[model samples]
Every structure is written in structure tokens, then in C-alpha cells.
Target: MNTQPLDDAGGPTAGELGEHAVIEAIVAAAPSSSNGDDAAVLTHAAPNSQVVATTDMLVEGRHFRRDWSTPEEVGKKAIVQNFADIEAMGARAVAALLAVSVPAETPVSFFERLAAGIESRVAEYSAELVGGDVVSGDQLVISVTAIGSLGGNLPSLRLDRARVGQRVVAHGKIGWSAAGMALLERFGRENVPEDLTEVVAAHCAPYLTPGRGVVARATGATSMTDSSDGLVVDLTTIAARSGVSVDLFAEAIAPGPELVRAGEVLGVDPWQWVLTGGEDHTLVATTANDVPSGFREIGRVGKQSGDPAVTVDGAAPHYHGGWVSF
Candidate 1:
């Protein structure tokens, strides 16, 4: 591994650094100490605890564009989306393995910054980077596998646990990421307004409050999921799985001032983002008891009864847009 510092031009390409050097540089930048190892040993879990795992993949042109986001931002986004899934299950992240495939021409500095970003975000939670593999490919692809612990005596939150008469609650920002994406598409990053910079930042790397699932679980949450797809899409999933219906209050989940201002600028309805935008990584859960401090009541559960699985103010939503892998 070359220990030489990168200059403004990003120093060397991955081909020049070689696979071993690239992996060494990445591990050096991150929190893992598993050098020259085929596998990493995970920490032991407490008795009666359950482990949850999830994997997500990001592609260069499809999921992210290098010109639109810095390598650090892409790295942070990768970690957040995967970890959010763990939290959605009412578990805390403990470890993660990152696998990266990049063209031989890709810059080594790109991965260094990316590893720094992963290390920074993982440091926020009690987790480690562990070990992974790197390979040369035609394009850049990042895959992360995250492992979490549902602490002793704690039950995992499930989509099927939601029932009729429970309150639908949410914590964390909704629609901000979509608004930021819109801003970037419309005005470009440099031309975006000073006040809306945060919105743009959200799209790059969404911020999720740590331990939200544990808090919701402690407060008697019935079911939980992260709004990775969209408010309506994820809630509809919960409704279908639980064999119930969700009635959302439009006012309760209305776009905030930033979204409203963004809508006016883009001539797009703010509700479009609020109801259909994805990647906010907001936590939405159902509770029969009190709503926790960090969460707000956005809707309620009801009988499915041949109606739409999810609705807004007792009517079908006008916008049915959300992310679809296909």
C-alpha cells in the first residue's frame, strides 16, 4: 500500500495502486484492523438477544452520479441507508462489511475519502467496519452488509405487528431529501439558495437519529419501518403486511417551510415530495400506547375492509409516485 499523500489531481488511479494497495488504503482510512485476513470475528451478543442483518447495493450511474455527489457523501449515504434498515427492525448496528468494485481507472483518492466518510458515520453508532473485498470492474459498485443486535429481552419490530386502532407515528425528516434532489436538478449545487443548502445536504447524506428504534420500542411501538421508499409506499407495505389500513393526516405530514419554498421555486406540489419521495430514511411506526418524545402522530391504523391500503384524509392519494427498482 502506498502511504504517499494525494495531491489536488487525486494522485494515482486504482490500476496504479493495485488491488492489494487499494484495500490496504481503504482499511487504513476506516476503523477496521483486520489486515491480511479472510474474515472478521463479530462481537458476542448478550443472552436472549437476536441478530438482524441487511444488505444494500449502490451503482455508479443508477444509484449515484460522481459529478453530483462527492465520494465522501456517497460513502455516508451508503452507510446510513443500510443502518437505517437495522434501526427499523428495532436493533442497534454492531458491525458492517463493505465490498467495493471499481474500474481500474478510478482514483485511489476517491476511495480514501469514501472510507473516511464511512468511518465517520459508523463512529456515530456503536459499530465496526470489519472486513470486505475489492475488485476491478467496468463501473463503481458499493455493497454493504450490516449486522445489528436486538438487545436482550427486546422484541424485534415487525411490519405485521401493526393493528387497527394504533397510531401511526414518525421521527426524523421527511421529504427533505427529495426537495434537495429537486433543487440540485433544477438550480445545480452552486446556484442553490443559501437557505436551502441543508436540503441539498440531506439528499447527499440523510441524517437519522441514533437509537430511534429502541426508543419507539420502549414506548410500546406495535410495528416499525424506515421510510426508505416514501411515506405512502412504506405505510402501504405495513398496511398490506398487517392486514390493516392506514389513514394519514395530510396536515400532520405536510411539507415544512423548506419544502414549501422549494416547491414554489420548482413549480411542483410540495405534497408530491411529502407523499411519494424516497430516501429520507425517516422512521415510521405504529403505537397503541403513548407516542415517544422524538416521534409525532401522523396517522392511524384502520380495518382494510376493501379500501385502499393507505389514504390521505379519507381519500386516495393524488400522487402514487415512489422509487421502483425496476
Candidate 2:
């Protein structure tokens, strides 16, 4: 997987420079004071607004594979996950702190590309990378803590806010990530069909719009979350938290041709992917009135009879929920 060995004069290995030098190189272009400070000091644009922060980690061989994703892709995904978390609270992404653990033999170019990826993605929302730390480990591990602003007056959209009789809406694509993972697992990186290229890309690094979560709040969305986990699982979180049940109308969610084609290739039901597959970063929300533009209705919130439940087309989904750590 080495594009060129770090031993080459053009690219140095991490061990060649040692930890302090490696860290200086990694944080050289960072926008935040975290590079030199013992701790980063932050102040919000709207001092009256509430602050929202979230952290996420990606470990090699667990969350991703070097063969399937480039260092930049992994870095971008690490930022996106934390950004999505802030957005889930109906807030604007503001800043990030990164931490990494990599093997001594890793190439220095990998750090350069990874830092570039984080900077590029966060720059979409005018966010900053305030600070981070680097250390040695058996494999690559990335941790990101993203901070966001609610901007004074807007109420945060949370998992516990969905009400019975509200419409459950979605604002991004779904199932493609799962389909992409399936293709990668079955075909590896060789001889992939042209039709599956998009699906494969989704699994590698699903697209995420920076400010969609704030838009959901402005649209009067009662509750919101990104589909980091399976649709049913994340929806179930809202349902349980709000003491409501959610019934998804499968007919309302029309899987695209790409997803259906991937399913056909895998001999599995595409709806299962829609119902249980995750990591699409799709925005799912509930609102009493009509959803805003770019949003679509797929389900409804209802009073929980006894236990909070999530169902598809009035029945339980056959597939298991996604990305179980255990």
C-alpha cells in the first residue's frame, strides 16, 4: 500500500524526526492555538448561545482499512463524524481538536495528507482545528473532538423532543454506505463493476453537508440526528428517548437504482440495507409541520404502547442493527 517507501529521500519516516518534530509538522498548518498551548482556549461568536461538543474515534482494522481508504479519506471521515455529532444537536460546527496514534514506521507523508483532509472538510463551514496530540501505537488511531454553536436563540433539536403526530423526515441519502461496504468485502479493490463505483465510494467516505443540521432546526424539526448507526437503531434512540414509537413506511423510501443493483449483486434485499445499514451521514429528523426543502417524509412518530419500538411497513426488520462494537 506504500505509494513510495518513507525511506526514500523524498519522504521521511515518522521515526526519523522523532515525536516532537513529527507533532510540529502535523500541527504546522493548524488554525487554532492548540499547536503551542497547554490547552486550547475557545470563545463562541454568540456568547449567549449554548455550546455543543462531541468526540469520535476511528481505529485501523476496526473502523477502516488502509487498503480500502487513503490516509486522507480516513482523516476526513474522522472530522465528518464529529461534525455530524454537533449537527445532530442542531448546532453549527465551529472547531475541532484532533489526536492520533500511529506506528513509528508510518510515513510522514501520511500525516501531511491526513492533516490536509481535516482542514479541507472543516473549512467548508469555516471551522477551525484548534489543537491535537500525537503518540505511538500498534496501528493508526484517530480521535476528534468537535465543538459547535447553537447561536443564542434557537432551541436545540434533540433525540428526546420528537412528539406523537409529527412527521419523520430525512434530508440525505441512505443505504449506499452499507451497499458500498458489501461491495468492498466481496470484491476487495480489484475488478469492481462500473455500476458499483458510487456505492463503493459511499462506504469509503460518504458525503456530508456541513450546515444541514442547523437548517433542520430552522425548519422546525422537533428532533434530529445523523444516521451514523443503522436507521432503525438511531430512530429507536429517538423513540425511546421521547417515549414514542416510530413506524417507517418502506414504500415511501424508494431505494435508488444503484442501491438496488448492489443488492441484486449481493443477493440481499436492498430494503434491509435501508432499514439497518448505516454510516451514510444522512440527516433524519421529525417535525410537526411540512419539512423544509431538500427533505422527504418517510415515517411518522406515534405514542409508545409500552416499550419504544421501531418498525418498517408495520413489521420488525429482519436485519440486525449496524456497527456493533462488541
Best TM-score goes to which candidate?
Answer: 1
Query: Which pairs clash in model 1?
Result: none
Listed in order, each prediction's TM-score against the native is 0.95, 0.92
Q: Global lDDT for candidate 2? A: 0.81
lDDT of 1 by residue, 57-109 (tens): 99986777676677888889999999999999889888888899989888888
Superposition-based RMSD of candidate 2 using all C-alpha atoms, in angstroms: 2.7
Per-residue C-alpha lDDT of model 2 across residues 1-326, encoded as one tens digit per residue: 23332223447778787777667666764555544688877763687888789998888778877667766677788888889889888899989988989788877777777787788888887888888888988888889999898975768988999999999998778888888888877877454588788788778777777788888888789899999888989999999899999988877775789988988898889887887887888889999988766778999998895543987777776665676887
Q: Identify the candidate with maximal lDDT.
A: 1
Q: Candidate 1: lDDT of 82?
A: 94
Model 1, position 171: C-alpha lDDT score: 92
